[model samples]
Target: MVDRLGPRYASTLGWLFATMVSMLFVYRPPLSLLMLFLWKVVGLLPRAVPPVVIARKYRDARASVLSAFNAALTLISLAGPTIIGIVASTDPALPSILRATTLLIPIVII
Candidate 1:
């Protein structure tokens, strides 16, 4: 797919699909296990394409950029739950906010 469409389009579509999966999670459709399964399958590309793109684009600085990327991921993973907990405790609209944010953030980022 990347070979055919090139990395830019491929990554954009991959992320759009990911954003769709996130929306499905928010909306709670039927047969969601199927969506989840397909998401996991398709999610591989979004996880992988960036580093591979970075590797190709920044041959010399690939390690540094990838390391920084991984570090940011780690920090998000560590901080996300604590922040969620704090917000969930104080905010009555926490679920709504989570749903909106989850849906909106990826779209904006994409």
Candidate 2:
């Protein structure tokens, strides 16, 4: 699949599948077989594709490019949370928005 579609595309699809599964959480479904089904399905997605695709994509990349990519990722990761934290810390309603995003982290860890 990676060879045919390319690592970038395959990785995108992997993350997309994970995101689609995660969207189910917004419904606040009751604890039942369905909730278990969603959790188990979401867990499978990143394990299935992301690590291999990401590792393969970067393994052969030049050191300079990888360094730049890492720096960019670090900047974005830090900046987003810092900005959101600042907003949520000051605003009452913003915390819910930040809390909503908490659902995304588990799948991302996978």
Candidate 3:
């Protein structure tokens, strides 16, 4: 399936998948927490796809920069849930905690 799509399509698909997984995190934290393992799977796709596409289409320096950006993004994405969990657990009001968590989503997405 991936071979048929080409690297560009594969990379775009990775972005789409990541975006969808991220949306799940925002819309339903409980469900997102339950499907956290799937996030790991989606996360791996971008790590592999972007570097391959960048190296093919651009110079080494450009590819390296893109790879670095993706790596930093992945790190931030990994940290976000843990931070949200800590906040949600520490807070007394569930709604307020959820609202706080939702606010972080846009920052992460940006």
Candidate 4:
């Protein structure tokens, strides 16, 4: 299945699998730290890739709009964790919700 998708998508799927499996072992401190690092690296990927990809794939006015959109998304992505952390900390009931949402982050990104 992976071979059919080519390298980028295949590696993405592999990373997702590794991250999900890592979460199962997260009760162990060292394993949890490793998983956290993996998740962090994966989380940064979209910010690193999208603007350049868009710029390369388009030109002139369309490229400008795509670049702007990509920039906004990157900024939002960077801010998302901080915002979620603040909300989780300030509201007692929100931590569980945030945790549930964040579970997908590790799997999808890492």
Candidate 5:
């Protein structure tokens, strides 16, 4: 897939796929289960593509780019749930937390 699509497009597609799937979590229907199932099938691309994209995109600054990427991932893993939890408490709605989480998605996408 990466060979045909290229790292940039493949990674973008992965992120877009993730965004669409994550939004479905708010729905909580029989369809949501289908979406979750689809995600489990395709989620590997995003995890595998990003490092290749970062490596190619920042060829000269690979070390710093990786460091920054790792740092951001660390921050997201720690902070994402916390932000979602706080918003979920005040509003008790999925959309509210989705909105908050969407703010961070762009950071990773860029």
Candidate 6:
């Protein structure tokens, strides 16, 4: 969905999400389960690259692109537990803001 939206709009959405999330820390607003789930959904959005977009983007080298993508996903899967463990170890009481920040890292990079 985000890839289909293209880079500009995708960036807009990311900024909007960041702004809303930062407000939680700034204002200390009451958090809801739905909002937390939405944050996760947003964080996961960048990982969902549509096949059509991938096909179009790498028309000349689809196989190579796909292989690289697959490798990256594998690396991420392998590293995720390590990354989470390190982050979680830093503070036993990992706050929601920190959790959300960790989740949003990929989206921000995208």
Give the best candidate by TM-score. Answer: 3
Local accuracy of candidate 1 as per-residue lDDT tens digits, 1-110:
97998765665555445545544543442343544454444434445467867445444354454456556555544443344333333433334554455445534434
Clashes of each: 0, 0, 0, 0, 0, 0
- Determine the C-alpha RMSD for candidate 4 after optimal superposition of all C-alphas: 19.8
Residue runs of model 5 more than 4 Å from their true location after superposition: 29-110
- Over 1-110, each residue of candidate 4 has an lDDT whose tens digit, in order, gives 65698655564454445445544333222223544454454445455568766455434444455456556555545444444333333433334544455454534443
lDDT of each: 0.48, 0.47, 0.50, 0.47, 0.48, 0.49
Residue 25 displacement in candidate 2 (angstroms) = 2.5
Pairs in clash, predicted candidate 1: none
On the 0 to 100 scale, the lDDT of residue 98 in model 3 is: 50
lDDT top scorer = 3
Order the numbered candidates by lDDT, best leading.
3, 6, 1, 5, 2, 4
- The 10 consecutive residues of candidate 2 with the worst lDDT sum are 85-94
- What ranking of all candidate models by TM-score puts the best one first? 3, 1, 5, 2, 4, 6
Model 1 weakest lDDT span, ten residues long? 85-94
Candidate 3 lDDT by residue in tens digits, 1-110: 46898655664455445546754554443333424453444344445567767445445444455556556656556554545444433434335545455445555645
Clashing residue pairs in candidate 4 are none
TM-scores of the models, in the order given: 0.29, 0.28, 0.31, 0.26, 0.29, 0.25
- Write model 6 residue lDDT over 8-109, tens digit each, in one string: 556445544554554344334333465445444444434479867655554535445445655655554544444443343344244555556655654443
TM-score of 3: 0.31
